[model samples]
Target: MLQVEDLHKSFDDFKAVDGVHLSVEKGQLVAVIGPNGAGKTTLFNLICGQLQPESGKILFNDDEIGRLPPFEICRKGIARSFQIANIFQRLSVFRNVQVSVLSQQRLSNKLFHPAAQLAVNETNHILESVGLLDKNADVAGSLSHGDKRILEIAIALGNEPELLILDEPTAGMSPDETATTMALIQRLAEKQGLTILFCEHDMEVVFGVAQSIMVMQQGRTIVQGDPQAVRENTEVQQAYLGDE
Candidate 1:
């Protein structure tokens, strides 16, 4: 479980996240839905320690972690994926995931290891979970756009995180691909018991998979509740219906 209180972040006097607060319970699939520049991603960065909040407190299971570094946050059972497809273009799919598993070991000298014999056991397991096991040996750059996004998810899963923060998990995908990815996320939360918090512009995806939704506007959370409640909210309807 995680808790954020009075979080605020700014860039050169431009406030991005203004006093946002929220909580994510264990095994809960929570969606942070909002218009662009609503501070969804900025709040994530603050939670994961990518950017320090101007003023706030972040507690992971009651342990204050606002000042922790990104790696420290990952070590504490939080992992994330970006809105964009971030993968090693030249490396094999297996190798790409292997890097994530290897980093968890905290062995500074093992960065260049082939990760073939060293990480195959764990890497293969994670790849299989994301449905990319068969393509382990293929060049990452050669995969289709949807596959690349799946690979990014696999990389994040390699950490075996307790709370996964996904930024636009269905971005840049066909309807079929979006459905597949949403199903995968739902399966992970329901079967694997992984807590999920994600930001998405796709209302269909958010409402389909998220148990709860948090709606934000101009760096503030306007409403937080069940998916149907958020859907019926006048503010959310006005702000996001036309966008979808």
Candidate 2:
């Protein structure tokens, strides 16, 4: 559902993303893993329109979105969660998702309409999908760290994206939270048919949950394959695991 070809991005003399290529098929769960400075986040920025590629193409469902702005790219059925939670902390969890849903429907500015009544069912449905239905009435700032991450995912779902890009979805979670979040991601792919691509530093999470993996080094992909194949790759062990 997504294709990135010969992508390149640079900062002065440094190459943050150099000649990288990646693809994620429909309903696929893919992970990109590498150490710090390997350019995973830069690649995401290029894909999501936070940064334009110096060269190369980013195609979603065969449409070239390389130069589109972030909002236009979002409207083209792509949604992303940041490394940090991005939500209205002062609002109720339900309100957070409701705002997103309302914005997606272009009703965010309908001041004459009852804001609480707009997209009620849609907001509740997204909350339930991410296992946040019970906490819908709670203030977003009051949720646990792991729950906050889940809430961000719930917010991303409000866009009804065909492909979801999660940047470190389980970054700061405890073991239990990591397991639960990964399980939710897998379930979302299977049940909701959402194609997921995520960047993670956790080896266990990447190998355990991802059906396919891309191992990157110094801004380029060195290996790409199924989990078992990638796990046993000599280059990955030598370049990624054996580096230090």
Candidate 3:
């Protein structure tokens, strides 16, 4: 559903995303993995239109989206979550999602009116899907770190996106939290038939949940394949995974 061809981006002669090419089919859960400076996040920024590519083309559903603005790209059915929690801290959990739902439906201008109330059912369903329905009335900032992450996911889901780009969905958490979050992501992909492309440093989470893995090195795609093939790739081990 997404295709990035010969994409390149640079900052002061340092190429952050150098001639990278990749694709994610519909309903596939793909993992992007690499070392610290491998440009995974940069690639995401380019794809999401946060950073314009110096050259190359990004096609979503056969439409050219490389030149679109971030909001326009989002309107075209792309939603993303950042490495850190991106949420409204002071709002109630339901309020946070309600705002996103309003934005998605172009009802943001009605936020001060009773029209915002129209999103209640949709907001509740999104929160329930992310397992945060019971916490709907709680202040978002008061939640545990893991719950905060799940809340962010709920916010993204409010957009009803066709493709979800998650940057480090399990950045900081206990093992149990990480496992729970990964399981939730897997379930979402399976049940919703959602296409996901996530960048993660956690090898266990990536291998455990991703149907395909793309390994990056110094801003370029080095190897991509199924989990076993990626695990056995010498270049991937030497460049990022190491012998361990």
- Candidate 2 — worst ten consecutive residues by lDDT sum? 110-119
Which runs in model 2 stand beyond 4 Å of their true positions?
A: 111-115
Predicted candidate 1 versus true structure: per-residue lDDT over 73-175, tens digit per residue? 9999999998888899999999899888877765426767654367678889889988999999999999999999999989999888999999888888999
lDDT of 3 by residue, 49-126 (tens): 999998999999999999889999999999999888999999999999999999898888889885457789999999
Clashes per candidate (backbone, < 3 Å): 0, 0, 0
TM values, all candidates? 0.94, 0.96, 0.96
How many residue pairs clash in model 3? 0
List, residue by residue over 153-208, the lDDT tens digit for candidate 2. 99999898999999999989999999999999999998988899999976778887
C-alpha lDDT of candidate 3 relative to the true structure: 0.90
Where model 3 places Cα greater than 4 Å from the true spot, the runs are 241-244
**lDDT for every model?**
0.88, 0.91, 0.90
lDDT winner between 1 and 3, please give it.
3
Which of 1 and 3 is the better model by TM-score? 3
Whole-model alpha-carbon lDDT for candidate 1: 0.88
